[model samples]
Target: MLYDRIGVGYAHGRRTDPRWLAPIVAALGDARTVLDVGAGTGSYEPLDRTVVAVEPSAEMIRQRPPGAAPVLRAVAEALPVRSGAVDAVLALLTVHHWPDWRLGLAELRRVAPLRVVLAYDTRRHADFWLVREYVPEIARLELSRPSAEQIAEELGADEVVPLPVPWDFADGVFPAHWRRPRAYLDERVRRSCSALAQAPPAAVERGMARLRADLDSGRWEREHADLLAAPEWDAGFRLLVSRR
Candidate 1:
């Protein structure tokens, strides 16, 4: 319901970054049949696999390209598929949005022997320049969701792989624009990030005003000069893989 409102233009900024694809596909391994839970716009769905998607937002589902995976309107806590129906289940950057992430993890475990989740460590992500300096409220909001470690523990994960955000990462998620500060100034980019979209408007407005002033006055550049030389930084994203 929340996404149906904010997800209107999701496809515009939520394209897949190839850097993430290699690791995700590798985690999937030999799984021929894959279930993509909370699959928004069908990004990162392997084209060679037999993929079925489950998404709650009609707006997001509608934006799926014409030949993308067939999807069912369903929640992660209640997947429609039978037990062990697929070789693997993929939940990408969507677990935080679930009302009950524990129940959703249970459902993911029930449906497949292999589970792959893309999640973040709230503490680390909260330190990002955008969240730390600009929108501190987003950090408070992140505190309410399960962290990457917690999700990995619940899923009995075999591995928790760090996913460093490349400077030019294509996906416009919250931390994707760490190097490109200007990206956050765009209203459309902010709308695509659920954290920015859901954060209090007054807080966001105040933060943006300060950010704009800093950018115009060259203060941002002077403060974050070190970041400009880095090719990638860990924005706390992790790929949790469970093999049962």
Candidate 2:
């Protein structure tokens, strides 16, 4: 599994952020049962609901905390549950990793009356400060991601809401610590972000060196000072909701 090799200890950095949960909880909309596809480390599973998780990576499954929902070793393309078996299905930041995302969406639609997906637009991510300034290779990485529009069209989504990342976002997902540039220097933080891990190691080292130099000289702070005052940033994250 991709995560098993590069994603060990992911839970240490990638815990759920409360600010990102309200929208997800609301989208659930009275659903008694939820199927969390690609459920990694059980970060976003609502404690108030009956939740079942489907995950392919054994490493990720092993990382789930003591009281997390039951997880099945399965891929999204072929869920073990029956058609309409759950009230809602949630796929968060995991669709782009699917080997066959369209087929996976069909499986989610087959098993639930409501589907909610958290996705990103590659173009928007390219404009982010980290990618634009430090890692140009991230532009290529973003290009490979399944676009927000593509996912919305596939699911026939009824709502696509913007999900701007908070400056102090607790989740260790990409670009979450936009205001805290130093967080990027931490190995654990980068380990949880696939974009950093996937980039060539030498290129990553070069980017990090440049970033460190910029921070020491106050060049980064000077360039992005406006971001310090902003409460949140739009990094192209979107929530796609579909109800049938």
Give, for candidate 1, the lowest lDDT window spanning 10 residues. Answer: 122-131
lDDT of 2 by residue, 88-181 (tens): 9999999999989999999999999999999999888777788888888888978887899999999999999998999889899888889999
Please write out the lDDT profile of model 1 over residues 1-244, one tens digit for every residue: 9889999888999998889999999999999999999998999999998999999999999999999999999999999989999999999999998999999999999999999999999888777789899999998888888999999998899999999999999999888888899889999999999999999999999999999999999999999999999999998899999996
Cα RMSD (angstroms) for every candidate in the order listed: 0.8, 0.9
Clashing pairs in 1: none
Error at 135, model 1, angstroms: 1.3
Instruction: Output the TM-score of candidate 1.
Output: 0.98
Our tally of clashes for model 1 stands at 0
